[model samples]
Target: MTGDGWNAAVRRRLGLGRLLALGGPEDGVWITERAATSVLGAVAAALPGLAVTSLRLAPADPGAAAEPAVPPPPSALPPGPLRVSAEVVALGGRPLPELVAALREALFTAARERLGLVVSDVDVQVTALLDDLPDPPNGGPPPGPTDQPASATATAALTTPGVARLTAELGPPVQTAEGHVRVEVATAPPHHPLEVARAVRTAVGRAAPDADSVAVLITWAG
Candidate 1:
């Protein structure tokens, strides 16, 4: 890559923040920062007159989390409680405090219910008082090969007790390379994602016994 290209790539990553643990270190599941932001931003945009201008997440206390039995991905932070900082724009009319309070509660609830994210707190920064509501934005991966390790891994992951479904409507739900197994899943509701992810790991183990490592990324909770 050229100097300009490398700088652009670094800036993009800085904007996305880091991979977030879905439940805990023990769960061994993670979601990309971009995915988490999309979830939270959608919740805010749906509210009557508010819109999220920015949304970011970070470990509430990185030092509190001890080393895990399984290491997290190199780009991921260790499992720990997370803190959310969101900047929102709201149209004038309702009290400002009410708008902030509502957005905060909605975001917190969505983080836990929809994503199974353990958020320590949400800090809302009202960036602007918009004169009107902003227009909402509109919104595939390839199909997985039918044979071999990925197919078997996909089957095992889907059949796992707490996995809800494949995480994305398009792309392959499971991918494998050498000894590494990577899977993305939406877990069944009311089940802690950590438990579900751990189970998926076990299932992957049984299905791909020769595999050296498995990584589960939970993109949704229900």
Candidate 2:
């Protein structure tokens, strides 16, 4: 199917809601199904050696209508809790159950804290186990500058103390600009945001000193 057609089908199957207005109508706070999905996707993508193949959100009541019945009144409220499900491909040798459990926790925490939405359930399906390839013989003749993958940048960020995990939305973790390196991360809580940012900068610097500069973003503190 075409992209738009596929999205329409997903909307029909999942019964997604439109942008939800929160608090007084004049307050102007709002959240969209797309936003919620983005948050959840980020959480899942952050897991080391795991790749999210698909993510779906379903209404708490499966039979609910696909579209809202009427325009919300002035005092708009959030929608009911949702059910989240995902398909993933994992690399490395970590136990599947352990990874799923961690993904569930991260999803729950992120949904609650970021969107104030309650996720009633998180179902993770491991569709594939990727083999870990052995390193090139003799260290692969050292990578040339700019040959580094974003995953390497993410690994450098993960090395920082107290960093729980990088957000999956940060695809490839490293962005290069004008000879500088930029790294973005979302960390689990218990550590201050500023401290985590500092740690990430230091770690990235050590890992890639050739980088003209290292920029770090703490997308999540808790």
For each candidate in turn, the TM-score is: 0.72, 0.43
Residue 88 deviation, candidate 1, in Å?
0.6
lDDT of 1 by residue, 1-222 (tens): 899978876775564457787776566678767667766777888888787777899888878765544555557777788999998788887688888898889989988877778898899988788788677653122222233233778889888888767654212467667787778777665676667888899998899998877888765544
List runs of model 2 lying over 4 Å from the truth. 1-30, 62-70, 73-78, 132-222
Q: What is the C-alpha lDDT of each candidate?
A: 0.73, 0.55
Candidate 2 residue-pair clash tally? 1
Residue 98, model 1: lDDT of: 85
Number of the top-ranking candidate, with lDDT as the measure? 1
Local accuracy of candidate 2 as per-residue lDDT tens digits, 67-171: 222233222233445677878777768788888888889888876665555467888898888885222122112111232354656678876876665543223
Clash-forming residue pairs, model 2: 150-172
Q: After superposition, how far is residue 194 of candidate 2 from its true place, in Å?
A: 23
Model 1 whole-model lDDT (C-alpha atoms): 0.73
Evaluate candidate 2 by giving its C-alpha RMSD to the native, one decimal: 15.5
